[model samples]
Target: MKLTISDLAKMTGLAKSTISGVLNNKDGFSEKTRQKVLQAAEQYGYVPNEIARGLSTKYTKTIGLVIKDIANPFYSKLTKGVQEVAGEYGYTVFLCSSFEDHHTEKEQIQAMLSRRVDGLIVAPLLEEVTFDHLFDLKAKSVPFVLLGSVPGLDSSYVEFDDYDGGRQVTEHLLERGHRSIGFAAGLPTSRASRERLRACRDVLSAHGLALRPEFTFEGAQELADGVEIGRKLIAMKERPSALICFDDVVALGVVKAFQSEGLRIPEEMSLTGFDDIDLMIFPLTTVSIPTYEAGKALARTLFGRIFGGPDTPPQRIVFDEKLVVRSSVRTAAN
Candidate 1:
C-alpha cells in the first residue's frame, strides 16, 4: 500500500503542517523535529509520490536550471556544483539551455513552470531582458536564483569579480611593458563581459595607455571564434604584443592561432586567459575563480532563503579572484 502524507504524519505523531514544513525544509521547526520526521519516513520506507505531492502541496521537489550556454566550461562547473548539493538533498534538476535566445528561454521557463518546479536557477539571456515570465513565477511564490548579475531583479545570485579580473589582467600586461594589449571579449550577452571590458578600459586609461579600436573583438564562447579573433589580432599591421582573452578557451585558441602563424609565445606575443579551465595543463597565465565553490555557495544561499525566510537587506556574496602566473605571459623585450 502506498503511504500518504497523512499516514506519515500519523506515524510521526506530528501535525500535518509540521510535516509539511519538514518536507519543504521550512523554518520554525526545530532540528529535532526535522530529524524525527525524516527518521519516521525512512523507517517506513516511505517514498513521496511526486504527482500526489504536487496536487496536495503544490510543490514539485524539482528545480529548473536554465543557462545561456552549457557548452562553456564555466557553466559546466556551476552545474557540477549544483548537482552535487541537489543530490544530497534528494531533489531532481531539470536542465534547460537558452542558447542566448530569449524566445526559447521564455518557452523553456514556461515548460518548467507547467511542470511545477519548486525553484529556478538561471543564467538569463541578457538580450531577452523580459521579466514578465519571472514576475509570474514570483507571483506563484517559486524561489529563483540568478547566476551572475541580472538587472531589475532583486533575488539571490552567485557571481565573481569580473571587473577586478579584467583590471588585473590588463594591469599585468602594462606592468610587463607591453603597451599594446589585445582584448578578446565574449558575446555581449552577459554582464560579465561588459564589466570585464570596462575594467580593462579603465585600467588602460589610468596608465595613460591608448586602447586601440582595432585591438578589441567580440565573439561567441566557442574555440573556433577564439581562434579566428586571435588570428585577426595577430595578423594586424601593428598587432599587440600581449593579449587578454575572455577565457581559457579563447586563450587556447590564441595559442593555436599564434602557433599557426609561427609566432612564439611571450616572444612575439604574450597571452593570458580567465576561468582557469581544468584541461589547461600547459600552465596558461590567467585568473582563477573557484567556479565549484561559487556553485556550492549559491546553492547554500538559495536553500537558506527557501527555508530560512526571505533575506532582508539583499544578501550579496562576493569572492576574490586569483591570478595564476604561468609561462604564457612574459615581459616584453626592448
Candidate 2:
C-alpha cells in the first residue's frame, strides 16, 4: 500500500490539519505535537507530495540556481552561500550548470520553469549571447536576478568591478617601473574581460605607454589555454617584463609554461592574475572578488523581488574588488 498524510495523522493520533501544521513548521503547533508528528512521519517513512502541496499553496517554495561551471572553485564557494541563505528561508535550491554554452543555458531555464520554481538566480553566460532568454523570463513572469552583467539589460544583478580590478593590477606593475607589460586576455565575449582590458589599456595610454599588439595573448580563462599563451609570449622576440593573466585559472597554466621555458615569476618577468581564488597556482598578485558574499547577496536580492512584487523596480549592486599584493609582482623586482 501507499502512505499518506492521513496515515501520519492516524499514527500520531492527531487531526490531519494538526499533522499538516507540524509538517509545514507553521507557527501555531505545540512543541509536543511537532515532535510526535515528526517521529511518526519518520517511523512511517512519510514523504509529502510536493505537487499536491504546491497546488494547494500555489507556491513550490523552491529556487533554481544557474551557474557557468561548478568545476570552478569560485562557483563552489558561491553555491555554499546561496544554500545557507536559502535554507534559512525554508526554500530548496535546484542547481544547474550551463558550462558557458547558450543552448544549454536556455534548456536549464526551461526545465526550471516546468517545475514551477518560485524564483530563479542565474549567473548568466553573456559572452556573445542575445538577451532573448531574459526577455523570455520577463514575458513568462519569472522572477530572476543576474549574478553578473548581461550588457544593455536592466536586470537586477550583483557584479565585481572588473574595470577597477584591471586598472589596479596594471597600475601595480607600472608602479614597479615596468612599462612593457603583456596582457593575457580571456574570453572575448565576457564583458568583465573587456572591462579589465579597457581599463588597463586606458591606464597605460594615459601614462604615455601603449599595449603593443605583439604583447597581447589570448588567455581564454582556462589553465591549458594560459599555458599556450605562455609559450607564445616566451617565444616573442621582445617580450614584456610583466604579464597580466585573464584570471587565476589561466594564470596557473601561464606560470607552468613560463617555468618550463626557464623563466621565473617576478624575477625575470612579473605576473598578475584576477580573482584571488583559493588554491591558486601560486601566491599571485591579483584583484579579489568575494564570491561567497556575492552568493549570499544574490539570494537576498532574489527573495526581495519574490516578496516585494515583480514590479518592485529591480535593484543593482556592484561590489568593489580589492587589490591583493602577493608575491607575484616584481618592485622592478613588491
Candidate 3:
C-alpha cells in the first residue's frame, strides 16, 4: 500500500485540496498549514511524483555537472564543492564523467539537456569543444557554467590563474639557480595547458633564458605519460638539471623514473609540478589552486542566474594559485 497525497492529507486530518495548496506553496496557504502538510508527508514517508511536478513547473530543480576525469583528485574536489553548495540550496546534482573523450562529452550533454536539468556545469574536454552539439542547449536557453579553461568562449567561468601558476613555478626554479630547466607540457590543445606553456615561455623570455626546443615535450597529464617524458629526459646526453611538470600526477611519474635511474631529487636534479594534489604521498614542489573554492563560486554565480535575478555582466572569476615549497627542488650550484 503506497502513500499518496490523499493519504497524507487524511493522516494529517486536512482536506486534499488544502494539502495540495500547502505542498505546492500556493497562495493563501499559511506557513502553519504548510508545516503540517510537510510533517504529515514526512511521517507517512510520502514521496511526491516529481516528474508530474516538473511538467507543471517546467523545471526539475536539478543540476548536471560534467567532468573530464573522475579519478583526478582535482575534479573530485570540484565536485565536492558543487555538491556542498547544491545541498545548501535544496537542489539535486547529477554528476557525469566524460573521461576526456569529446564524443562522450557530447552524449552526456545531450542526455542532460533531454532530462531538462535546470543548469549545467561543464569542464570542457578540449580547447575545441563541438559548439554544434551545444546548440540545442543554447536554443533552449539552458544556463551553463564552465568550470575549466575554454578559449574565447565569452561565457561565465571560474578558473585558476594558470598562466601565473606556470610563470611562478618557472621563476621559482630559475631563482634557485636552475638554468637547464626541462618542461613536461600537457596536451597543447587544452586551453589550460596552453596557458601554462605560454606562462613558461613568457617567464623564460623575461629572464633572457632560451627555451630548448628539445627540452619541451608535450604529453597527457597522466602518470604514464610523465614516466615516458622522464625516460626521454634521462636518456639525453646532457639532460636538464631541473624539470617543471604539467601537474602533480605527472610529477609523481617523473619521480618514479628518477628513482629508477638512482637520480636523487633536489640533489642531482630539481623538479616542480602544478596542481598541488594530496601531497601526503611524496611531497613535491608545486602550486596549489583553490579547486573546490572555484567550483563553489561558479555554482553560486550559476544559481544566481537561474534564480537570483536578470542577467548581470558575464562573470569571469580566477582563483589564486599559491606555490607550495617542498623537498622537490634544490638550489642549483652556480
Candidate 4:
C-alpha cells in the first residue's frame, strides 16, 4: 500500500497542515520541525501526488518551449541550456517545433497550453512586417518569452544581436579591401534572415558601394541550398570577391560546391558564415551568439514571469554578438 501525507503527519506527531507546509517548502515552519516532517516522510517512502498537488495550487510546474527547428545546432544548443536550468528548478519543459510556419506554430502553442504548462518560452517565427499568429498567446495572462522579438507584441524576449553580426561579416570583407561583396540570405519571411540582410546592405551602402544584385542569392537554410548558391556565384563572370553566407550549416554546402569547382577559399573568393555551428570543414570566421548563456537567461526570465505574478513587468533580454576570427578569411590585395 502507498504511504500518504496523513501517515507521515501521524508518525511525525504533526498536523496535516504542518506536513503540507513542510512538503511544499513554505515559510513559517521551524527548521527543526521541517526536518522532523521530512525525515518521517522519507522513512515511510512518501511519493507526492502531483495531480492532486496541481489541483490545489493551480499550477502544473511545467514550461513550454517552441522553436523553428531543433535540428539546427543553434536551436539544439539553446535547448540544452533550457533543459539544464528547467531541471534544476524542478520543472519539465514541453518542447515543440514551429518549422518556421505560422499554422504549425499556432497548433503547437495550443497543444502546449492543453498540457497545462505554467508558462511558455518560444523562438517565435515572425516577419518584420505583417506576421500571422502574433497574438495567439497575447490574450492569455500567462507568462511567456520569445527567444527572438516580434513586432507589435508586448512580451519579454531574448534576442541575439544578429544585425551587428551581419555587419561584422560584411565589414570584415570590406576592410580586407574587397569592394564587391555578396550576401546569401535565408528564407525571406524569417526575421533573423532579414535583419542580417539589412545590416549587410546598409553597411555596404555606407561605404558608397552598391551590393551587386546579380552576385546575391537567397535560399533555404539547408546544405543543398548552400551548395547551389555557391555553384551559381562561382560561375558568374563578375562574381563577388567575398560571399557572406546565411548560416554555418548552409555554409558547409557552399564550401563543398566551391571545392568541387577547383575554387580555393580566400585565395580566390572569401567566405563567411553566421551562428558558428561546430565541427566545420574549415575553421569558420563568423558571428557567434551566446547560445548556451542566452538559453539559460531565457529559462530564468520565463521563471520570473511564472512566479513573479501578473504585475511583474516583462524582461526583454538582448544578448550580445561577437566576431570569431579564423583562417577562413584573407586580405584581398588589388
RMSD of each: 5.2, 3.0, 2.7, 3.1
Comparing 2 and 3 by TM-score, which wins?
3
Q: Write the per-residue lDDT of candidate 4 for residues 261-302, one digit (tens) a residue.
A: 999887888888888876675877888888988889999999
lDDT (Cα atoms) of all candidates against the true structure:
0.80, 0.86, 0.81, 0.84
Q: Which ten residues in a row have the lowest lDDT in candidate 3?
A: 127-136
Span of ten consecutive residues with least summed lDDT in model 4:
127-136
Runs of candidate 2 with Cα error greater than 4 angstroms are: 6-43
Better of 2 and 4 by lDDT: 2
lDDT of 2 at 154: 78
TM-score of each: 0.83, 0.89, 0.89, 0.87
Candidate closest to the true structure, highest TM-score: 3
Q: How much does candidate 4 score in TM-score?
A: 0.87
Per-residue CA lDDT of candidate 3, range 1-334, in tens? 8777788877889998898788777889888888989888877788887776788887798999988877888888888899889999988999898877788888999888888888888887663546655555545567888876455455677888888888888889889998888888887545677788889888988888866989988865789998888888788888788888888888888889989998788787788887788654776899998888887987887897688434555578888888999988998896
- Relative to the true structure, candidate 3 has a C-alpha RMSD (angstroms) of 2.7
How does residue 322 of candidate 1 score in lDDT?
80
TM-score winner between 1 and 2, please give it.
2
Clashing pairs in 3: none
Cα deviation at 21, candidate 3, in Å, is 1.1
